[model samples]
Target: MDLVERLFAGDKRACARLISHVENNVNGVNEDLKKIYKETGKAYVIGITGPPGSGKSTLTDKLVKLLRKEDKKIGIIAVDPTSPFTGGAILGDRVRMGDLNTDSGVFIRSMGARGHLGGLSDATSAAVTVLDAYGCEYIFLETVGVGQSEVEVMKSADTTLMVMVPGLGDDIQAIKAGVMEIGNVFAVNKSDRDGAKRTKREIDMMLDFSKKDWRPSVTLVSAIKDENVDVLLEKIFEHRDYLLESNLYHLERKANVKNEILSLVRKEIMERVINNDEKHQLLEDLSHKVALRIENPYTASEIIINELKK
Candidate 1:
């Protein structure tokens, strides 16, 4: 049987192989994705994001353990920062989640960010698609703790959890508007630490300014100690149920698809510009003109677009 067929049959090796192809941009990977696309959209995607040292990996590990108790088949995609020299994942999140490695019900893969500033690898959505098609009931997408701009999780997750820890001075101020807006649930990880209450209060104060119909919940939990993680899990389900009951699930899925399409289009256009000799020359010429102040960026972009049209 082919990879997609094996994947559909719950072959873990097939799932890992397909994700590897997607990450490396191997030839025909997109076509492979097309074959399995119809089987996706069944899994519930949960995104965990926060700044470095926030214990996101530990939180994810604990959450997976809890999910296992419910007989939930899980797929975890942990995005880690790429090493500048080796071009590989620097901090292997999989190492932190080592306990799940032996569990057949849980499939975990770590991906290098590879310079993607969004805190996720470019292949993240596709990897999620593969897992979704593989019949995973719950898919956890853990981002490389790359601060604020990591809000790209909103484009892929049904429920986005903003993980924060105490003792990070001015934590509220450190969270950007983009990050604040994307959170469906807030988790104060390492709640045993000093100032955990103050952190929760600060988040509460900021959330009060919002007038959304569904207010995001802030739960304090010590991921390392596995304390109150069940409460956090309940909150996650509550958010998921809200999406389904409010008829917002399909709406969010549509938006997620739109974002994925736009991202693919942008990547393809960039690759085209860089690979075509004539276009590459035109880009360099335009860059030189911009450097000399002979042409502004808007006009240069227009010229490039015109060239692309031809």
Candidate 2:
């Protein structure tokens, strides 16, 4: 059987192969995705993001165990930071989630950010589509712990959870502007720590400044201890319910599709500029011209774009 057929037939290896194709930008993968696009949209996508050392993997492990109890088929895409030298993921999250490997209901994949700056590999959205079409009822996308400006998870997730831990002075202050704005649910992981209450208060105060229609809820939990994980799950479902009841789910889905299309278009244009011999030569020439002050960068870019049009 073909890959898509095998995927629909619940072949785990097929699902993994398809995901690899998407991640690697394999030839004709987009066509394959188009063929199965209609089979998607069934799974709920949840994004978990935070700063480094926030215990997101532990929280995800506990959450997956709870999800398994309900007999839900789950897909987990864990984004790891790429090593600058080796160009591979360091501290593979799969090791932390080893117990779930034997569970047939769970499918876990590790992806390297590969120099992408938005805390996710560029293929993450496409991976979600493949898993959704594979009949996963729930898909969890865990991003590389990120700092300010890596808040891209918001554009993709149905419900975005921001995980924070206490006792890191000034870290919250640093990300309060960017990461704080993206969370639908705020989780203060390692709630047993000394400053957990203070961290929660800080989040509450920051949230009060917003005039959004829906308020983000903050819950304290010890992921390692598996404490209050059920409460966090309840908050997740509540946010999902709110989105569906308010018709925001469809709206978000539309926006996500638009964003995906725009991203693909941008990537294609960049590839053409870099890979085509004539365009590549033009780029170098334009760079020299701009460096010598023979032409401004804006004008050089316009020339390149016009050349692409021709």
Candidate 3:
């Protein structure tokens, strides 16, 4: 049987292989995806994002363990920082979450961010689709510790959980700058650490100024000690329910599909028009012209685009 059929037949290896293909942008993968795309949207996508050393992996592990008690099928996509030399994931999460491999109900995959901005790899949404189609009830996307500009998870996930630990002074600034806008729920992980209550109060105070249809919930949880983890999970579920009840679920899904289509169109144009072998020399000549001040890049780009259109 083919990969899609195998995936539909409950084959983990097929799922892994298909995700790999999507990540690498392998030829004909889009066709494979089309075959299985209908099976998606069953899984609830949760995006987990925060700073480096925030124990997101550990928190994810704890959350998965709790969910598995109810026999839920879970998929984890850990967007690890790319290795400079190999251009592949550093695989830190794989090491931290290795024990979860014993559970057939849990599937973990680590994807290299590969310098893609917005804390997630370009293939992340597609990989999520693959897992969602594979019958996962919940999918956790752990981003590569992001900053002010990396708030794309809000667009991709049904719920966005921002994980922060106490003692990071910079995070206080980060929250005020833009994270406060994207996060659906705030988690003060490693609550055993000093200033945990202070951090929670700071968030609560900051949240007081903002008004929305659904207020974001802030919770302190010590993942290592398993303190309040269940509460945090429930908060996430509450956010999901709010989206569904408010009719934002359908709207958000519409926006997500629009973004995905636009992204794919841009990618296709970039590959077929600008990166074509026939255009390579033209691009180089335009670059030289621009470097010599004989032509500005705007006009050069227009020239390339017009030429391609003809």
Candidate 4:
């Protein structure tokens, strides 16, 4: 059967198989993704991101339970730092979210960053597409940090939730400028902490200074006790509706597709060029020349560009 049909058929094994192919960057899956591109944009993608030790995994576990109770199929992709030697996740987000793994309605996958600059795996976008095509009503992407590239999730997600906690020293404010800018909703996890209320107050003050018409309300939730998690779900659906009514959903989806296409094309072309014998030789020669200062980089680039053009 074709990939799209197999995915929508609720084939868990097939979904897992396809995700592995994408994660490994198999050539055939690129064409498969192109074929199913139209079937995407239907899933409501949501990203849960914050600093380390902020209870993102616990909150995700609870959110999955609530979503499952509603009979919604959910897909989760958790990005964790990779061990340089083993290429395995350091945090074991998959193990942490084990409760949701047994449910047929939930599919969870943990990916190593593989040295990707954004605290996300390079294969993350493709993996998300696979889940979207698999008929997941809601897809959650979890990541650490607020790197510039981390904002890519905002393009894929209909709503982005920035998770934070009461304590964490300067890192909380360090992420504020970047993560806060992308958050459609703020979640203060670990509300049982001593300064949880004060943290919420600071977020509220920051939002008050924003000129954006849409106000991203802050909610305090204890992921351990599942406190106020129901409210978080309500806000998630409300944010979904808000995006649809405001007509930003369709536009954001379109932009995401455009960016994906460009990124894939650029990466493919560069790989091809680098593998070509003459281009490779030229690059080697340029490296040697720069090492010796016999030729400068600016002129060397023009030579390579001219050669590639021919």
Candidate 5:
């Protein structure tokens, strides 16, 4: 049997291999994914995003443990910062969740941000797609924790959880309009620290005026101490239940599907334009004109696009 068949047969090694192929951009991997794409849209994606040092990883670990209690298969895609020199993730996957390796129910993958502005890497959606086809019931996408721009997580997640800590007033203010509005559940982690209530109050105040039909719940929890974590999980479930009951799940899924499709189309077009050998010299000429300000970029782009039509 081939890799996709192995994946359908519940082979963990095959599942890991497929994710690796996606991450590394192996040849024909896109074809492999096409064979399994129909099996996707089954797993519920939860996006966890926040600023650096917010203990988002710990919170995810706790949540997975809770999920394991119910015998649910879980997939975690943790996107960490990339090292400028090495262009690899600064944090290792095993180091982040050493204990979870023994559990067959959990699959963890650490990916580099690769300078993607939205906190997730280019391969994230693909990795999630593989895991979904691999039969994971829940997929956790932990972002690189870049502030403000992390709102992109909402596009891929069925429900997004914005993590906060007791401090970092500036970070909170910066993301208020961005990730703040996108989160379906707000988790004020490290609640044992001072100002926990103050932080929760701030989120509550914002949600009040936002008046979203699904009001994002803000919960104070200490992941290290395991305090209020169960409650946090409950709030997450509540948000998921709300989406399901209100029939927003299917509607949101439609939007997400459309968004992913459009994004893939744009990416494919760009790749084709840039990688075309015949247009290489033309691109250089256009760049030179645009650089010298002899020709505006709009016209140069139009010229290349017209070539594509030909």
Candidate 6:
């Protein structure tokens, strides 16, 4: 069997090697993904996101510890902002997750956002698929909280948790648009702080305003002491079970499949368009026209589409 087959056949070492290769975006990565894409969808992806400084990395570390107790193979994808100067992840989470990295059952990866929105890196969804096909029981995606793009990319998760802390103040309004409606669970970290209860009240009031069929539960937890960590884990499992019972699990997988295909298609077309000299020049000319207010991008796009069709 080939590398992809070996990974699906329970070869842990092969799985790790394949993932590392894909993360590097080496040639033939697309072929490798296509080969095993059909074998995926077994893992449950949990996306953890919230405003920065909300103790997300620490909470993820705690969650991994609790998950390991169930003898489940877990994969973690932590998305951090790229250094403006160096264009690499700040690597703060690597320092925090030092010991967890030593655990054989847990695989943790830190990805620089590389300018992706909603806190996820470009390859995150594919990485989640790789872990899923490799038979991981759970995959945790930690977002560093950029904005709408992070939420769009993370919608692939089976469930999404939005982490928040006290003292966001008026800046909290910045997150109101995209973060509120997307979270399946809301967590108030650093619950030991003075305004923790007030934050909970604020979230509860917001939930009351939501018309979602299943209310997203808000929980208070201190990741430093692992306080209420078990409760958080229980809620995660409860949400998972609820999805399964409601047949939403299958629907979620179907949605994920559609997103994956669309993402890949978008990437491929952009690549092809960039590589074609004629199309590249056409795009440049269209940009000039748009800048001059001569025509909009919609009409330019149609022109390119008609040309490509030929």
Q: lDDT (CA) for every model shown?
A: 0.90, 0.91, 0.87, 0.82, 0.86, 0.81
Best by TM-score: 2
Q: Across residues 170-255, which tens digit of lDDT does each residue of candidate 2 receive?
A: 53582357887899999999999898999898888888878998898999999999999999999999999999999899999899
Q: Which of 1 and 4 is ahead in TM-score?
A: 1
Model 2, position 62, has a per-residue lDDT of 94
Q: Output the lDDT of residue 34, model 1.
A: 97
Where in model 3 is the C-alpha error above 4 Å? 84-86, 170-175
Q: Kindly report which residue stretches of model 1 are placed more than 4 angstroms away from their true locations once superposed.
A: 84-86, 171-176
Stretches > 4 Å off in candidate 2? 170-175
Error of model 2, residue 186, in angstroms: 0.6
- The TM-score between candidate 6 and the true structure equals 0.90
Candidate 5 global lDDT: 0.86
Cα shift from native, residue 166, model 6 (Å): 0.7
Indicate the worst ten consecutive residues by lDDT in candidate 6: 145-154
Candidate 1 TM-score, true structure as reference: 0.94
Model 5 residue 167 CA deviation (Å) reads: 1.3
TM-score per prediction, in order, is: 0.94, 0.96, 0.96, 0.91, 0.95, 0.90
lDDT of 1: 0.90
Q: lDDT per residue, candidate 5, 1-310, as tens digits? A: 9999999998999998998898877899999999999878889899999888798888888889999999999999999888777786676544657778789999988888776778888788899999999999999999987676567788899989989887778435833567677889999999988888888888788778875687788999998888899998898899889999987999998888798889788877787788898887788999998999999999999998898888
Best by lDDT: 2
Pairs in steric clash, model 3: none
Least accurate stretch of 10 residues (summed lDDT) in model 3?
170-179
